[model samples]
Target: MLKTTLGQWRMFRAVVEHGGFSQAGDAIHKSQSTIHHAVQKLEDSLGIKLLQVKGRKVGLTQAGELMLRRANYLLDEAAKLEAVATGLGAGTETQLKIAVDEVFPQNLLYRVLDTVSAQFPLLRIELMETVLSGAQELLEKARVDIALSPVPLANGFNEEFCQIEFLAVASPQHALHQQTQALSYEDLKSHRQIVVRDSASNSGKDVGWLGADQRWTVSHVRTSIDMISQGFGYAWLPVPAIEQELQSGLLKPLPLTQGVKRTAQLYLCFADGDRLGPAARTFIGEVRYQSESLLTAEQLSDSN
Candidate 1:
């Protein structure tokens, strides 16, 4: 049998967090005496001194510090329990917000979305196409329910979703392809390089950008592909995104001694995994299914 109540632990934590009984009471809309009584009863039940006081100042004892840690974890679990109950009671969500990095394969994304839509016809979905850290920012800010990003956000959970292959290429007729020898950094830097701008507002980043004498920054991968195919500049573009250009000889691979091909692993991250409703869970499952199916199909094609 449990001798202590969660209510007592809640009050105990509130006192420590707010720095005093009166402050805790004010914060929790309880009287100071009530808060003090709860904490006192909690300590009595636990048979330990949880707090110390000196001249109107309150601080936790050594044992109180450990108890406070456990109290925090307990309270967090309780909150998550409530959130799970609430989500289950709410049934399917009315809307789903998702942020997807531009690098993720469009075919796979579209297929998954089509499947999810068929399952939940009335569920509204707001899909934001982002570049680089844009998806991470949206997920971190709780603006999106889920995000696909190359790098996982700090203090969040993520699962490996897929790997995107980026190939450095230029137009077949471009001057760089005229060289017989493998291209060096100096050789590539002399020509114009096209780069996709990171879509994050405040903390955008640049990747796969060589310090070329001339550079063009665009907002989307398609824009970069279009510019590069027109012989305006050279850039590393995702293989799935530039398949037609590759097959048609519009874009030829740059023969770099190193980094000719780069692979980035994308992760599927949830803003709040525990609070995801039925719709979000369904979407996540479909994403996994579609990604695996695509990979398997591609492998079979390669094998043949």
Candidate 2:
């Protein structure tokens, strides 16, 4: 059996990347002959002509192209393996399971995740989208390493993260909007309320007004918004989720004489925030960076 080493593959990759043995030698600080010898040994072990001389440059043979493509990924994973090892040596966790409130804007969440994923490509991420107090429950049960919750837990480290605007809205054609005067809390109590159910396993407490004579409870915020759009009921909806709806005048904000529309304060709570590992810390940083944009509400039709 031919002995093929990581050093041989690395030298082969450098040659492919630099386009020639001499150039690869210049880049890796080795003699041109040494680079050529290592790649030649790699080709011999694999029984293939990995490179061919094309003018003053080197071109990958068909077999060489395939091997090189695989080598790139192999090298990436090797580098990641070392990163993970070094992180482990420095007390960094290899994986982090997180639960975030679904009320948080998905676009913002995706951006934060994208940034953090690049920072720790090898770190395993287990993300759970929760509603209301679901994230709190997950953390309580030790089911997640980190959590972003709208409600603060009685214990542990809790810090204000961001606020999401919740507009009291109804379809223009709805009965509530037909009134000429602004609404009172009593006025809303008479109309049907569209409510999003909590995602917690233990059943979470209902938020906002539950005193409506008629109410509809659904599992997701989208469903509640859909019902509101259909003129079935009125509910407080996130401005970001209904940006298109608000712009198109499909959903109009209800004017409240008393409380008006609201914003919920979401918090970053960790079981042990200070003692978190590098992976968790990096995730928190990414979240904080992307969250600022989400806090600034998308322009609604009018704050009436």
Tens digits of per-residue lDDT, candidate 1, 1-304, equal 9989899999999998888999999999999999899999988888999999956878999999999999987987788798778778888788889999999999888988888889999999999999999999998777898999986988678899799999999999899999999997788888999999989989658887567999989999999999999999999899999998999999999999888899999999985687898788889999999899888988999999
> Mind giving the per-residue lDDT tens digits that candidate 2 earns over 158-274?
879888888889999998889999889899888999988899877858988778998888988888888899899999888778888899988999978865578998899876554
In the order shown, what is each candidate's alpha-carbon RMSD? 5.3, 16.2
Clash-forming residue pairs, model 1: none
Q: Which parts of model 2 have CA positions greater than 4 angstroms off?
A: 1-92, 293-304
Give the distance in Å from residue 92's predicted Cα in candidate 2 to where it truly belongs. 4.9
The alpha-carbon deviation from the true structure for residue 118 of candidate 1, after best TM-score superposition, in angstroms, is 0.5
Q: Pick the candidate with the highest lDDT.
A: 1
**What TM-score would you give candidate 1 relative to the actual structure?**
0.73
